[model samples]
Target: MFDVVVVGAGPAGSMAAKTCAERGLKVLLIEKRQEIGTPVRCAEGISKKGLQRFVEIDRRWISAEVIGAKIYSPDGTEVTMAEEMAGNEVGFVLERKIFDRYLARLAAKAGAEVIVKTTFIGFERVGNALRVKLKRMGEDWEVETKLLIGADGVESRVGRIAGIIKTLKKSEIESCAQYLMSGLDIDENYTYFYLGNDLAPGGYAWIFPKGNGCANVGIGVLPSIAKANAKFYLDRFVEKLEIRGKIVELVSGAVPVYGEVATAVADNIMLAGDAAYHSDPITGGGIANALSAGYHAGIVASEAFEKKDFSANFLRRYDELWKADFGWKLRRNKRLQEFFLKLDDETLNSLARSIAGKNIREMSIEAIIAELIKKNPSIIELLKSFLSP
Candidate 1:
C-alpha cells in the first residue's frame, strides 16, 4: 500500500509527489498519456512573480523571456506595461513540454514511482482507506493507498468520481485555442494582449513570444458569449493581422476561470491544481497556483498519513493553507474581472487612454477601483461587495 497515490503527472501531480517523497512518504504518480506533456494545451505563459515563488526556472525550459506587455484596445489604443516599472519580467513564455518533463523527473528523482499511459478508472473506499482502480496496456490494476491526490486537469474525472462537485458554470469556463507558428515578423520578446469584445468576447487574445520569429498566439472566450469555436476567433485574428507563417502546432483546451473550490479536501482525498479550480479568474493562468496547491497538498497528505488520520477534518488543513496563500488575491481578481466584463469597447479604450502613462503594478487595488468609481458611481456598489469588511 502506498502512502499517497497522485493522479495525473502534470505540474501539480509531480510537485505533490515530489514533496511527499521528499518527506519520506511512498508516492505513486500515474499519468494517462504515453508522455507527460505531449499535445500541450497551454499557451505556456506564466508570470515571473508566480514562477519564482515555487522553483527556480531553468533557462532551457523558457522559449522566450518577456520584458513587457502591450495591451491594445479595439480601436488600437495601446497601453504598454514595462518590466522596469513592474520590477519583474512580466512573464516568460515557456516550452511546456520541457518544463513538465523536468518536473516529473524531479519527482522521480525524489523516489516517487512514475507511471505513464496508466488511466485511473475509479476508486473503492474501504472503511478509512481508498483503493484506486487503474488500467494499463489493457490490463486492470489496483493500488491501495492511505491518501489520494487528484491533480488532474480541467476535465477532472477523479474529482467527480471521488464525489466532489466537478461541474463548472458556463461563465466559469474559458474556451481557449492556441497555435504555435514560425516565420511571424513580430516582437521576439514582449508579449501582446488584445482586449475588446469584438476581438474576444468576455475574454482576450494574446501573443506570447517564443523566440526565432516564432510565437504562440491564442484567444480565450467565455462559453456563454462564444458564438463560434475559439479556433474560429483565433483564425480571424491571425488573418486580420496578416501573419504569414507555418503552423507548427495546434492546441485547444478549457481553463476554469473560477477561484479555488471550497471543498478541495475530503476523507482520504484531496484535489489540487486545475482539478481544484485554483486558476486565476481573469488571466486563466493555473500553473503557478497548481504547483503551490500541490506542494501544500503533499505536505498535508504526508502529515495526515503519519498521524494515521485521513478524515476530512484532517485534510481541511490543505484548504486553509491555500486560502492563506492566495484567497484574497483571487477574490480581488474576480472582482476586477466582473468590472472588466461590463465595459464596452469605447469605455475600454477610454480607460486604456487614461491609464496610459500610469504603472498599474505600483497602484493598489483600492486605487484602481477608486479611479473607476470616479468615472461611474455605479461601480461603487460593485466594489462594496469585495471591499466590505
Candidate 2:
C-alpha cells in the first residue's frame, strides 16, 4: 500500500509527491496526459520572488525575464509599473513543457513512483485505507493508499469524488485563449495588459513576451458577460494591433477564478491547486499558490501517517497552512474584482489617468487598490459596498 496517491503531475502533484517521498513515504504520482505539461493551459507567468522561494534559478525553463508591466486603459492611457510592483503574473514567461517535466523529475528523484498516460477513475473508502482506480492503456488496475491528493486541474473529477469542492458557475470561470506568436514588435522586457469592458468584458487581455520577437498573446472573458467566446475576442484584439504577428501555437483552457471553497479537506482526502480553486481572483494566476498548497498537503499527509490518523480533522492542517500563505490575498482580490466589474469603460479610463503619473514603483494588488481609494474618491461608494458586510 502506498502512503499517498496524487492525481495529476502538475506543479502541485509533483511538489506533494516529492515532499512526501523525501519524508520516507511511499508516494505515487499519476498524470492522465500521455506527457506531462502538454497543451499548456496558462500564460506561463509567475512572480520572480515566488519562484526563487521554492527552487533554484533554472535558465532552461525561463523563456523571458520581465522588467516591468504596462496597463492600457480603454482610452489608451498607459499606467506603467516595475516588475516587482505588478501582480504575481509579471516576473517571467516560462517554457511550461520543460518546467513541468523538471518538477516531475524532482519527485522521481525523491523516490516517488511516477506514471504517465494513466487516468485516475475514482476512489472508494475501505477501512483506514482507500482504493484508487486507474486506467492504463485500456487496462484497469487498483492501488491501495492511506490518503489521496487531488491536484487535478479545474473541473477536477477527484474533487467531485472527494466531495471537497462544488461545480463552478460560468460567471466564476475565466474562459481563456492564447496563441504563441513570433515576428512581433514589442519592448520584449515588459508584459502588457489591456483593460476595458468592450475589449474583454469582465476580464482582461494580456501580452507576455517570450523573447526574440515572440510572445504569448491571450484574452480571458467571463462567460456570463462576454458577447462572444474567448477565441472570438482574442482574434478581434490581435487583429486590431498595429504589430502583425505569425502564430506558431494555439492553446485554450478555463481558469477557476471562483475564489476559495468552504474547505479543501475531507476524510482520507485533500484537494490542492486548481482542484481547490486556488487561482487568483483578479490575475487568474495559480502556480505559486499551487506549489505552496502542494507542499503543505505533503507535510500534513506525512504527519498524519506518523500519527496513524487520516481523519478530516488531521487533513485540515493542509487548509490552515495554505490559508496562512495566501488566503488574505485571495480575499482582497475578490473585492477588487467585484469593484472593477461594476465600472464602465469611461470609469476605467479615468482611473487609469489618475494613476498614470503616480509613482507606483512598489505597488501590488493591495497598493493599487489603496491608490484608487486615495485618488479616485469618485468610486469610493462602489468600493465601500464590496468592503463592508
Best by TM-score: 2
lDDT of 2 by residue, 2-74 (tens): 9999999998889999989999999999999999989899899888876776777799999998877788998
Separately for all candidates shown, the number of backbone clashes (residues 3 or more apart, or on different chains) is: 0, 0
Stretches of model 2 off by over 4 angstroms after superposition: 83-90
lDDT of each candidate versus the true structure: 0.85, 0.88
Q: Each model's TM-score?
A: 0.93, 0.96
Model 1 stretches astray by more than 4 angstroms: 85-88, 359-382, 385-389
Per-residue CA lDDT of model 1 for 1-389, tens digit only, reads: 99899999988999999999999999999999999988798988887887888778799898988777777888887766664643356678889999999999999999999999998899999879999999986799999998999998898888888777568999989999999999999976578889889889989998888999999999999989878889999999889777788899899999988865668887899999999888888878889888899999998988897888999899999989988887666767777787788889998888777666654442123455555566667657766775464
Candidate 1, 84: how far from true, in Å? 2.2
